[model samples]
Target: MLPFERIITIDRESKVPIYRQIAIAFINAISQGIIKANTHLPSTRDLSKLLEVHRKTIVAAYDELEAQDWVVSVPRKYVAVSAKIPNLKPKKWMDEVNESAYRALFQLPFKQIVVPKVKSNAQLPEVIIDDGFPDVRLSPIDDLLKIYRSYTSKKHSIRNATFGSAQGSLKLREVLASYLSETRGLNIEKEHLLITHGAQMSIYLAAQLLLAKGDVVVVGKPNYSKATQVFEQTGATVVEVGVDKSGLLVEEIQAICQQKAIKAIYVIPHHHYPTTVTMSIERRIALLKLSQQYAFAIIEDDYDYDYHYASSPYLPLASSPHQGNIIYIGSFSKLLDPSIRIGFMVAPFNFIEQGVALRKLIDVGVDGYMQNALAELIRMGELKRHIKKAKKCYFSRRDYLDHLLQEHLKSQVSYSLPSGGMAIWIVLKKEGLVEYLVQHPQLAIRRSAIELNAFRFGFASMNETELEQAVLLLKKIIEGFELQGVKGQL
Candidate 1:
């Protein structure tokens, strides 16, 4: 006989009734093959004695077993494990599937994206330097969330509960149309903007719609890496133009265009990524003229338009004439937080309509509730107030980081004080210095990045304390590294 007492340990503290516990135990026993088919169960009175429970409880357990078909009863004469129950075969719980299943057997239909190799650390570093991003600590998220909750509950807003148009929320677009006009000097209407998940999506849509196989798209040699990936996905030939202190060498782009008819150019006119070098007005005008001359589209990713400290930032290329050739991309995510995916593309009406149709193919729509909520935030002037506050905070952080770099790593590095943007483009004085710094245990630098003996120390994400901590760690690590032999440390 099975060790019935040992198999069915009772806990009085458990919320489950004593009788139900007995029933469940019997069922488990049968399933596990401990209680085989046609085995006679102990009598209720005997089980009651064994379990130290009342006979009524044992009787209830037997009744439950009988009702569930786990046991058969013979009119109070006998209660036995059901002969009708199938033979139980327990599985090998420790067994796993074959190892070959880890890798795909067949070819993927599309080009697989390359995943970057990350350094494996037992714990996350205390100091993380991001590639340029807005500080979330200062974002007006509480106010935005309150608006979101209100929109979700209010009956008047219920009609917009479902997925909105592919173009995006009408209210948000209208608000942006007015907002962009005022802030960035963009001459756009609701019809010209296509709200997307973020600036990357806008970049992708522009790249996909404007480019085709064998077409050429001119970009800087050290351009925004993600934008490069997007353009490459379209099977378009990417021509590399050189960027200088003035910005993209439009002369190089003209040289490329002379050889081949290009489709578009992805330019970051204000605070170019990694380097944070703003384009000169002369280059901006020259590029616009070249666009008219070559009939190529200009993807002006003016994401850091609002982050100026020196003077009022230059108006975007889209704000200039020849609007037909430029697709302007901007982001609210950069202004608030990276996680808040809200960005827009400004293009001609016909082009936007095509993008909308293409967008609908792969997407149902964006979050209508979030869009409306943001629109409310903008309409209330809360977003502008927040930007105004954040800009001042960021300006202070920028200067603080600048001072920290000058104080700590001035001997080992050289950099230009950026008039705007969240990061300073620090160029290392020694060879292999950037690569060695990347290996330091206490640091994780954002890598959109790390080319041309330079990297961006994204100051906006960290406060003065964090900036000080990061800079101090950086100084300590570099000092430990022997530079150019003679006991100079890596």
Candidate 2:
């Protein structure tokens, strides 16, 4: 007998149709090489008897597989595996036919736009380094579990059980408004808030609401890649403003605005993405002044303002008014958990009605129960305690990363010690440095090139011990790069 593994397991209670499930099992078997190419499969009658299903059901399953080109029927014996299967390459004549079909469908006469294929999440290599995610290992999960159980045990609030209002739960908004006023000095009412899926969605929605095709928007050089993509997708022309230690160059922004067609300025003033440099108060004032004179809006993305390791956090530009020119965006993802997916935009009161309307069309609203739960957390001062604890944790991690980098990779790379934020942007001493680092067997996936030599290291996720190991590995990779003498321009 052939070494074919049994692939089908019928789940009578499953919502999936039986025939479809059977077809999937067969395809899985074929892909796994359990059922070899050109091998004979048992007849429908035999399979029906083995599976305790009607003969018609087995026939239906086989017919479905045949329709998908997974198998071919032979006369009076058994079904032979087909030369072609969907998404499977069978090193045979079928490859030529499939290649021709694919070319006909995807190839164009003109110069084709090369779109990078999106890697599935499952295909992405797991990051064993401490820098890949936030440090959730130390989270007070026991406390949270207790809170969750207590909250869920109560009678389900009908308001929270259904899709929430587009404005988010009023209680959450009210709590947030007070928190912002007290913490960040931004005095805002609940009516001006529109909860979103996350900071990215808020940015995307704001771009959609404010920008038109071919409109000009100034973005900081080496900014958030995801934000850049969102603006590009909206058909806006993104002009990059250079940054020094003080943050974005105000003169470059003024020069762009002078062109008289710019729509908005996107910035992360508290701690800029990748670079982790905070904009000075003078620069913030200049930016706000430019927005007033130039007739464009400012998208103030206050992404990591909640956790300041330094003396105190800087107040957001939105807190100081330039008369409805600022659209302030904030998120709880970093403070709580990324999975929470809760963010809010504080717009001018005049724009709130339309903004909420747009939000309704997007996701209907943020998760109602989560919103209510967060509201309760805020009301009970649990969120405040969480933020305080998170700040201390992040501060320790940031300091440890800085110390390790300086101690290990000092001569090869340089980065500023940021006061706050989850990441540090390292500028390599030589161009094409990341490509060399990633070639190491240990770091073949984790290290990625942002532009050329510049890369981001998110240190908030790892503990001091893990960070030490990572730094040692990174140093070894850099030493190898130097030995190779691989020279390229940044």
Candidate 3:
């Protein structure tokens, strides 16, 4: 046996528990090749005496190591490092040089992989106008935590944390079935739904199942860029369809269908991204007909159907009768917070079965503990109450922003008040606004579509004070441009 004193150190002053420290020391020793596989460890009593710690502490440390499969205990015998551990020691100088030389001898055929532009490192201003993210500060987190703690502390919840179905928690699916049916008029059953990490994952799963190499997928111009990237990542070619005030031009999509076999058409009809244009009912019927004629899948991303302000929002195309070839996805990330990462996809049973299989390969399952707690929240009617409360707050912010824009920016910018969703699409009439805003360290905005002149200003995430500050700064910038007689160029 190796000397226990040489292999392990007990740091009584550290914030980490004595047992955890002991287990960490053993792990480090094993990883660094100081102890070989199947090497016996000192007895719990001896190690305890050697480290001057309690015997129970040493026992706890060994339990941890065994539980993690780092060590194993023989029947009526002492514990030893697991023999299953494969040697992974750091390579010597010659071995590393030889490996590098071996790799250099091969000519790789892989294409250049460009990094996706999901986020930027540009310095944030004092006040940021986001693209319709929810104000998580207003969420019912206290109540959620209380119920979460209650569910997880139960003895049966051990299975929930350890293993779960790839289809996600059955309870959550059942609750969502009723919830979507009641709210959005979707008549879905638990068998037709698959839970995902977020709307992004839902999009990815659909792409993997429906798209193949060189398959054509149609997306709206100025679409959700993130979803576009996800579809393209699956080796499918993404074709852009121009979007107008009435949403995607279905006539243009029909024109494309005559040219090639299209696999899918991805669209966000309700309050379309960046522009916030709702698809006309006429266009919706026309697109549905085209999908049937071409036998292509329609990936409908109804991201923010919950937060409508002007009137009751239109029910999703998936909720319609005779709805086929439609894969509808929605997310609660905006309702609660993006970090929650709860999203669901509704489709035909066969598609759902395939999606669950693919999901198992990527992630074993969604968070069972979180899904169960959310279901409880839905059952207790807390989720509905929170949405009601949040709606009122968001409506007020939207109107306040509207009033501010009309008062301060009417001459320099033009916008249509969105009937729903959390942002107003502002079209800049002058060119210098983007450059001028750069000088002001207290104002931030998101550019819309492919044009730097069009921007989206979301009010839901900011308080009224921050909103006012941002607009006032923008007004000042525009006024300075007007005085110089500078016509804003695209």
What's the TM-score of each model vs. the native? 0.79, 0.76, 0.76
Residue-level error in angstroms, candidate 1, position 166: 1.4
Off by over 4 Å in 1: 1-110, 448-451, 483-485, 488-490
- Enumerate clash totals for all models, in the order shown: 5, 0, 3
lDDT of each: 0.86, 0.76, 0.84
Residue-wise lDDT of candidate 3 within 48-113, one digit each (tens)? 999998999999999999999999998568899999987767433222221224556458677655
Location of the lowest summed lDDT over 10 successive residues in candidate 2: 91-100
In model 3, how large is the Cα lDDT of residue 477? 69
The local lDDT score (0 to 100) that residue 382 gets in candidate 1 is 91
Poorly placed runs, candidate 3 (over 4 Å):
1-113, 116-124, 160-163, 435-441, 446-452, 479-490
Error of 2 at 198 (Å): 0.9
Best by lDDT: 1
Candidate 1 per-residue lDDT over residues 1-490, each given as its tens digit = 6668876767799898999988987787777666679999999999999999999999999999999999998976889999998888743322221112346566557768877787776789878888888988889888888989898887777677464799999889999999999988888899999999999999999998989889899898788888998888889988888887888998888888788898899999899876888899999988998899989899999887888999988899899888488899999888888999999999999999999998888886689888998999999999889888988999999999989998988899888999998888888887677877777778888853456777888999888889999999988888777534545443
The local lDDT score (0 to 100) that residue 58 gets in candidate 2 is 80
Model 3 lDDT on a 0 to 1 scale: 0.84
